[model samples]
Target: MAGVAAIGAADLVAGFGLAGALVLPAEDPESVLAAWRSLPPDTAVIVLSDAAAEVLRAEPAVRAPDAPLTVVLP
Candidate 1:
């Protein structure tokens, strides 16, 4: 798991030219929340699953009290 996380972090830096963090998790809400929290303000989030988007949409903190969360679903 540690090795996988290292590789994923490396891949993100290599591909995105970002020293940004990447969180790959063992399960659902935790992974989703981690991804959400790790991203900076105004950054775009692209979700591969509609179901996951739905879950994300339901989180008030994810959307915020005033600002809408930007998510692209494929």
Candidate 2:
């Protein structure tokens, strides 16, 4: 449990970089999942844009009980 990471469209997630979060800009559902799969070891929080959240809404891995806290922005 440590820093924050964000994955989503460039415009939506760009601000996260200002806070020193690991920003991974993804274009599609697959890319979002790929980013999720490769999170840094120190990431304790993951922030996803609404579009990304919708893409992963049915993904079991994203909703895994043991995964880090995930926040989806509107």
Best by lDDT: 2
lDDT of 2 by residue, 2-45 (tens): 97999999999999999999999999989998998899777789
Residue pairs whose backbone atoms clash in candidate 1: none
The weakest ten consecutive residues by lDDT in model 1 span 1-10
User: Model 1's lDDT to the true fold?
Assistant: 0.41
Clashing pairs in 2: none
Candidate 1 structure quality by residue, lDDT tens digits, 1-74: 11111112222323333434233331355565565555545444333234445556777775565443343333
Cα misplacement distance, residue 23 of candidate 1 (Å): 9.5
Model 2 residue 33 lDDT score: 88
- As a TM-score, model 1 comes out at 0.43
> Which 10 consecutive residues of model 2 have the lowest summed lDDT?
59-68
